[model samples]
Target: MVGEELVGLTPEMIEASQAGMKAIGAAIAVGSTGLASAAAEMAIGSAAVGATAENKDVFGLVLLLTVIPETIVIFGLVVALLLIF
Candidate 1:
């Protein structure tokens, strides 16, 4: 969108894109494992609570935390889409 050129990306843009991809990869690795552990903890807690686990307060918190990992992937996809376009 520069000067009505609608030009494609430059070398610097490509490099920045590569760097962003690397960062996203790192984030996914760290985030996914964290989410998995948190979910496991939630499962354990639920098992402990057993019959009294009808209340969703703890479940909701764990669900939100688990979603953080997926959000990183979503953000990575958005960046990839931007690069493609």
Candidate 2:
């Protein structure tokens, strides 16, 4: 069996590996979300600039809308933390 092949590895080692893998997964989750947030922000920011140029009164609203994509990164961090802990 696979277990027999890994006889030299202690349970602690196996556990450590599992933990490392989970940490990697967590990092990946956060990293991916951060990338997505950046991309979304770029698109939103360009549009916001154009919109703001057209209407000074809407600048604040446009700014708020542009930051909405940041929530995705926040959520990703939360999920990553959950995965790690």
Candidate 3:
């Protein structure tokens, strides 16, 4: 079936797949953390400035978590650029 056909790929295809996965993970981290926390902060901002500020701190932590994953996209971009030049 189609599953068997996709069981293996060439080296280039494998690398591309890895790069795509990495980019996806990075996107989720950056997009989810940044947007979710920002929205949460916005929602809570009016009720309690102090607690909302604490949520901002959590947002910062989430942003930090996003960095490592985001590096994956950077690495992919570097490799792609190198290939182009």
**How many steric clashes between backbone atoms does each model show?**
0, 0, 0
Candidate 3 per-residue C-alpha lDDT over 26-74 given as tens digits, one digit per residue, 9 for 90 to 100: 6665556656555655545444555446676566555454354445445
Please provide, for model 2 over 2-85, each residue's C-alpha lDDT reduced to its tens digit, 9 standing for 90 to 100.
Answer: 978888998899999999999999999899999999999999999999998889899999999999999999999999999987
Candidate 3 positional error at 53, Å: 16
TM-score on alpha carbons, each prediction: 0.39, 0.87, 0.44
The alpha-carbon deviation from the true structure for residue 6 of candidate 1, after best TM-score superposition, in angstroms, is 12
Q: Distance (Å) between predicted and true CA of 85, model 1? A: 28
Best by TM-score: 2
Candidate maximizing lDDT: 2
Candidate 1 lDDT by residue in tens digits, 23-50: 7766666566556656665665556465
Question: For each candidate, C-alpha RMSD in Å?
Answer: 9.6, 1.4, 9.5
User: In model 2, what are the clashing residue pairs, if there are any?
Assistant: none
lDDT of 1: 0.61
Rank candidates, TM-score, best first. Answer: 2, 3, 1
Per-residue lDDT for 13 in model 1?
90
Q: Flag regions of model 3 displaced more than 4 Å.
A: 1-3, 47-85
* Whole-model Cα lDDT of every candidate shown, in order: 0.61, 0.95, 0.58
**Per-residue lDDT of 54 in model 3:** 64
* Cα-based lDDT at residue 58, candidate 2: 93
